[model samples]
Target: MAKYTLTVNGGNKEVEAMEDMPLLWVIRDLLGMKGTKFGCGQALCGACTVHLDGVAIRSCSLPVSSVGEGKITTIEGLSEGCDHPVQKAWVQHNVPQCGYCQSGQIMNAAALLTANPTPTDEEIEQGMAGNLCRCGTYNRIKEAIVTASKSL
Candidate 1:
């Protein structure tokens, strides 16, 4: 096992984990932060997305060692009071159904807006294409993104 001190959210977290352990496990298991869910265990699914150094990435397949000193941000870190524009927009548009994928969805949406504060419809579709919502809330998700973009 190797010891890693990760800068998560706005704080520091130290954990001991196998070098090959996925960051998702490190975040959810060792770190005990359940906000980042486990879904496919593969990178193809965006359900395990998180922000690494302010960029959205699939944590399920990312080896913990590769994270190095990069800052990590989970859904819990997205907003302390749940007032992030995307989060508010999510509620406004009623985007979640089963809600299993909503954390990842929110994290990805937050990152998308950060990179492009005002994204076109095509751009929003493309940016959010990888995130799959099992409840088939794509239309509502799109509407939330459009709404969030306006607030940003």
Candidate 2:
């Protein structure tokens, strides 16, 4: 086991784990930050999405050691009291079914808007492409993203 000090949600967090352990386990298991979910252990599913230096990344496949000095932002850190524009838009649009993947969805949307404050509908879809919502709330997700863009 090795020691890693990760900057998560604006704070420094020290943890111990195997070098090959995924960041998802570090965030969820070791750090006890549960908002970032584990869907497919592979990186294919964005259910474990988190911001690494403000870029959306699949934590499930990212080794803890590779994170180095990057800042990690999980859904819990997305905002205070769920006031993030994207989160507000999500609730305004009622964009969840099973709600299993909304955290990842929200995190992905936040990253998208951060990079492109005003994204067209097509761009929203393109940006949210890899993050899968099994409930197929794609339309509502897109609408929420559009609505969130206006608030950004």
Candidate 3:
């Protein structure tokens, strides 16, 4: 095992783990941060989405050693008391169904808004395309993203 010092949510976290271990496991299992979920370990699903230096990435497929010095931001770090604009928009639009994929969805939306505060509809669609909500809440997700953009 090797020691890795990760910058997560503006804090430094030290963990001892194998190099091949995925960041998802490190965040959830080791660090006890459970907001980032594991859907598909192959990186196909967006359920493990987290911000790596402010860019959204699939933590499930990202090895802990590969993270280097990138700042990781999970859903829990998005805001205090889940009061982020995207989160607020989600509540306003009632975007959760089953609530399994909402964390990743909200994280992705927050990153998109951070990069492009006023994204167009096509941009929002493309940005959120990777995240799948089995409950078919895509319309609500899109509306929430748009609402968040306006609020941000």
TM-score of each: 0.98, 0.98, 0.98
Pairs clashing in candidate 1? none
Write candidate 1's Cα lDDT for 92-124 as tens digits. 999999999999999999999999999998998
- Selected candidate, larger lDDT, 2 vs 3: 2
Mark the regions of model 2 whose C-alpha exceeds 4 Å error after superposition. Answer: none
- Model 1 clashes, total count: 0
RMSD of candidates 1 onward, in order: 0.7, 0.6, 0.7
Q: Return the lDDT, model 3, position 74.
A: 94
Pairs clashing in candidate 2? none
Clashes of each: 0, 0, 0
Q: lDDT winner between 1 and 2, please give it.
A: 2
RMSD to native, candidate 1: 0.7
Q: Model 1: runs farther than 4 Å from truth?
A: none
Task: Write down the lDDT of every candidate, Cα atoms only.
Answer: 0.93, 0.94, 0.93
Instruction: Look at candidate 3 and tell me the lDDT of residue 81.
Output: 93
lDDT of 2 by residue, 26-47 (tens): 9999999888999999988799
Query: Least lDDT summed over 10 consecutive residues: which range in candidate 2?
Result: 143-152
For model 3, give the 10-residue run with minimal summed lDDT. 38-47
